[model samples]
Target chain A: MIVAERKPFDEIKESIQDYKKVLVVGCGTCVAVCLTGGEKEVGVLSAELKLSQKAESAPAVFGEATVQRQCDFEFLDEIKDIVGEYDALLSMACGAGIQFLAERYPEIPVFPAVDTTFIGVNKDVGWYEERCRACGSCALAMTGGICPVTMCAKSLFNGPCGGTNQGSCEINKDQPCAWYMIHERLSKQGRLDNIMKICPPNDWRNQTPQTLIQPGYEERIESSK
Target chain B: MKSGSQLEKILTAGHFAFTGELGPPRGTNIEAIKKKAAPLKGMVDAVNITDNQTAVVRMSSMAASLFAIAEGLEPNYQMVCRDRNRLAMQGDILGAYAHGIRNMLCLSGDHQQFGDHPQSKGVFDIDSTQLINMVKNMRDEGTFLNGQEIDEPPKMFIGAAANPFAEPFEWRIFRLAKKIQAGADFVQTQCVFNMERMREWIKRANDMGLSEKAYILPGVTPMKSLGMARYMKAKVPGMDVPDYVIDRLKGVDKKDQADEGIKMACEQIAEFKEMKGVAGVHLMAIEWEHKVPEIAERAGMLPRPQV
Candidate 1:
């Protein structure tokens, strides 16, 4: 899932300071699961903004709205009637959803309230760890399901780069060396020979901004073209 | 002779080759390279010019190799995978060979997080193993990594780094074999402070018959002070500074610790000279380049063999 964290209160407050009315919009998907930009978070941010405005004697009004998913135009259409009532929108969603909301409401200035971190999984209630980099090519099969591109500090293909110390990465002792883990897992599976096979340099030309057509839908898009 | 480098010739002739290291100055100071090369010229077979080692910015290793050549010292040009992609690396290799650099060391350099510029991006387009294979293909097959034929490919005596002290110790020898299979003519290992582990690692390499395929030069760095010893033991990654060595330094006076460190390094080199499957000793005197001659002579590696 796309994990995000709320931006600092000061930066969020400053971005909406100029607007007299600001609507705090939240998403109910990934951000909600991570506890960063859910309906409850939006309510808390709205209350805090109102209190901060009152203390500063600023004539700013805080409003709140939550959508099922901000990335979809259908879900976004539900907020269309009330969106024009505010001078600015403070979106608490991932980067994609924030951009979608901005595109949908082109007139109102949209400010991001959260920083989209990475494609990751929730380890615990407030803890998230990055698992993938979307590098366009995946070699997890050869690596015993551990992603070296995302786990190793250097994104090494032929690795354990002399920097694997005590099963930890050279950069930090707390982080497990991705290659070490791969070695252990592969050794257990009797696939140790996989590591010895030299992997050629990755073809990174597909790493640019990519547009994907799902398997069945590819023919549909091609026929339309 | 693959590249006709002096180091390669010495090793190929079954002579115990000795190499020294020269870290280029942070600025554009050709005089520093010349100064460092002076003491090592007659004492060692070749000199390794470091490429922004530890991620600190320095004069380009290729450029420094030219200066080392100007000083009449054969340079083992070091190329790290941290800063360049395949195109730049191949271009630099061709340029270095054109400028008289015959030896090259392929390395996955220290992480940028430990360097002067921690905010910089690392470009590990190819790991050191792939780099070794790439250079080998360019030299032996006369083809680029993309399989394009080169009018004139760089014929370099390729070298790679090994760390016996790194984690998953059982895999270290296998890694060395992989490097040998990747067409490494020679290999310089990580700094060795724990002689016991190094001996076992070397014995394992010999058992696998890997030593016959490539020359193994174990690196030795003399710790200048007790603080340096402690820092290396506790801080440096993939380094194993045995407790006995630290205790030995502690047994000495504060002012005499430098000499004690040199004594330990000389002792290691002496053992490496007699050990089976040991090809040479790579003396990395670090910032204390002036002391390399003294260390080499004391270790009985003086009067370097001429091929």
Candidate 2:
């Protein structure tokens, strides 16, 4: 889930001060699950913005809307009609949604209400810790399905770093050393020998995209085309 | 267990009265906060300085309340348990009292996912009830949880919240009784829109001999528009909105809803204030602080006695 904390009203206040017409857009996916950037949050942000603007010398009220999902083109298309109506777009979506909104509506400036934190799962109602880095590599199979790219603080491919003391990371005592966890899991599986395998760094170009991967097969098969 | 002399006067006076709330600005700008508090300093008896309300992190509530007190506004430092544990909570209660913030309101805060920090873990080592008791133990006995008496125990008039409109209606009165038993000196309830249900609850409090003992102030936040009324009724947890309110909001013109909201709030306040066991009204007004005085006036709760 895309975890976020609501930006304080004053920070958001500065974002929409000069503008009279505004749109507070919420994404109803990962952010919603985490309770950050969702429809209800859009309402709250709208209310906060409304109050902040109303307090200003010349107050402004924002028009609000929520998309089913902000990252998807089809979902974003739903906002096209109302978005242009506003001078600024305050997005409650993740970074991908913010960029997608910017790309979709190049004329309208979009602002993020939430800092797009890493992808993670909710341990409970209020906690959502980050677990994935999306490093464009898959080494979990060799390491008991624990991707050191995302888990290990050092991303050590060989084995746990010396900083892993008593299963706790040196970076922060509260966090369990991810490599140690991997080692323990692998040890249980009699696959601790996998730690000795020498590994090379992953190539990064694929993640940025050489070109948009519009499915050629979806449009038309090569034989038919 | 009464903490301070100033608070002793307010509580012992029977109908416990006089409190306000201050909204911490989204940023750390002092001037920005002054503008927000410009209207609230003297007019309201006490102002609740929220600690990261809705779990949306902001300036520390304790620091802000201390600042408000410096500016001559009696600050009711609202302490939440979502971010702090028993140790920090104990420290804060004592700290607020030393700073001359005579009042404190305890709450189990909204989840952090609702706030800016979605990944931050929540420490709910104590709920609002436990926190209330912790403060009470410190205030009444001057002893820590470990049974050691401090040289000088902090003096703070403690308060807790009651959402009579939030959950199963049957549970609210029981909860209120429980909180009072836990040493809650006063109870400032969540926003009360429907007075019919509230009047009955007030009657129940009186029947249970609680009205005479505890201070129950129904919360009132003026609605800016019909959309807000409906939104709050549906969205805000533990908040109750009657069909008539929704009906009135629906019928009223968009431009005139604030007036309707004020009128509705005044009517609710007037009715609540007159009930046999009622204490007073706690007007939240959200960010519409400007409307609070008017609502208080309309609700006929103004001209508060100088206790």
Candidate 3:
């Protein structure tokens, strides 16, 4: 899931101070699951903002709203009427959703209330760890399903470097060495010979911002063009 | 005679080689490089100029190698993948070769988190294995990584590092084999304080026939003091400083610890000469270059073999 963390309250407060009415919009999908931006979080932030504004001489009104997913235009349409009442929108969503909201409403300035961290899995209620970098090309097959591109400190394609210390990365003792795990997994599967093969330098040109058209959707892009 | 480097000639001629390391000063101090290279000249086969070792920025190994050359020392210029991409790496390799550097060690450098510039972005576009292969192709095929032909290829005697003490201990030898397969002409191992483990790793490399494929040089760094031993054992990653070594250092007087460290290093060199599949010893007297000559003399490695 796309993990995110709420930006500091001070920064969010400062961004919306100029506006008299600020609507805090939330996303109900990835950010909600990660416990960063959801309906309840929007309420909490709205109440805090209200209290903070009241403490100051110039008080600003804050409103709250959440949609199923801010990335979709259909869910965004549900808030079209209320969005007109606010001078600014403080979006509590990932970078993608925040941009989508800004695109949906061109008049009101949209501000991000959370920092989109990474594509990760929720380890616990409050803990998450990154698992993939989406580097375009994947080498999981030869690497025994371990993603060296994301796991190794140096993103090593070949075997572990001299920095592997007791099956852990040299950068930190808690982080397991990706190549060490790959070696163990391949050795168990009797495919240790896979590690002997040299992996060429990754073709990083695939990482450019690409408009990926799925195979069956190519005709749609052509027709639209 | 790959690159016809002095280290390569010595190793190729079936002579037991000896190499020392020189860490470039943190600033542009040409005299520092010359001073460090002074004692290593005529005492070892070649001197390895480290590249931002331990993540601390220093004079680049390529530039320092030229200074070492001026001091009558052959330098094995070290290149790490941490700071440069393929473009910079290839460019530096060409420039180093143009400056008469024939030996190069490809390494996945220490993470930038361990360096002075902890916030610096590491550009590890290619890991050490890929770097080794890239250099080999540039040397053998006379082509760039893009397969474009080069007008003049850098014919470097490529070297890579090996750690026999790092864990998944059983896999260290296989890693060494993988490095050799990736075109490492010579291998310099991490410091060896645990002789038993080093023996096992070397024996396994021999069993896998890796010894014949590449010249293996076991690294030895004399522990300057008891504190240094403890720091290495506790702080340095992948370092295996045995309890006995620390205990030996602790048994000596505080003033004599440096001498004791030198004594232990000499003893290890003597054992390395007798060990099978061990072609040489890379003595790294970190910041103590003056002691290298004495250690080499005591170890009977003085009057370096003229290949």
lDDT of 1 by residue, A5-34 (tens): 999999999998889999999999999999
lDDT of each: 0.92, 0.73, 0.92
Q: Report the C-alpha lDDT of model 3 over B1-307, residue by residue, as the tens digit.
A: 7799999999999999999999999998777777888888899999999999999989888888989898999999999999999999999999999999999999999999999999999898999989999999999999999999989898999999998988788877877777788899999999999999999898999999999999999999998999999999999999999899999999999999999999999899999999999999999999999888898899999799887
DockQ of each: 0.76, 0.01, 0.78
Residue pairs whose backbone atoms clash in candidate 1: none
For residues B210-293, write the lDDT of model 1, one tens digit per residue.
998999999999999999999999888998999999999999999999999999998998899899999998988988989988
What is residue A219's positional error in candidate 2, in angstroms?
74
Candidate 2 per-residue lDDT over residues B88-205, each given as its tens digit: 8877777777777777888766656567887887765555666777777887889775678866787677788876653335435655676677778788887777778887888788
- Best of the two (2, 3) by DockQ: 3
Residue-level lDDT for B239 in candidate 2 = 60
State interface RMSD in Å for all models: 0.9, 22.5, 1.1
Residue-by-residue lDDT tens digits, candidate 3, A1-225: 999999999999888878999999999999999999999899999998998777678788888999999999899999999999999999999998999999999899999999999899989898999988888888888988999988998999986888888889999999999999998999899998887777889977555776678889988899998
Candidates ranked by DockQ: 3, 1, 2
Clashing pairs in 3: none
Once model 3 is optimally superposed onto the true structure by TM-score, how far is the C-alpha of residue B64 displaced, in angstroms? 1.4
Which scores higher on lDDT, 2 or 3? Answer: 3
TM-score of each: 0.96, 0.57, 0.97
TM-score of 3: 0.97
Looking at candidate 2 chain A, the ten consecutive residues that score lowest on lDDT are: A196-205
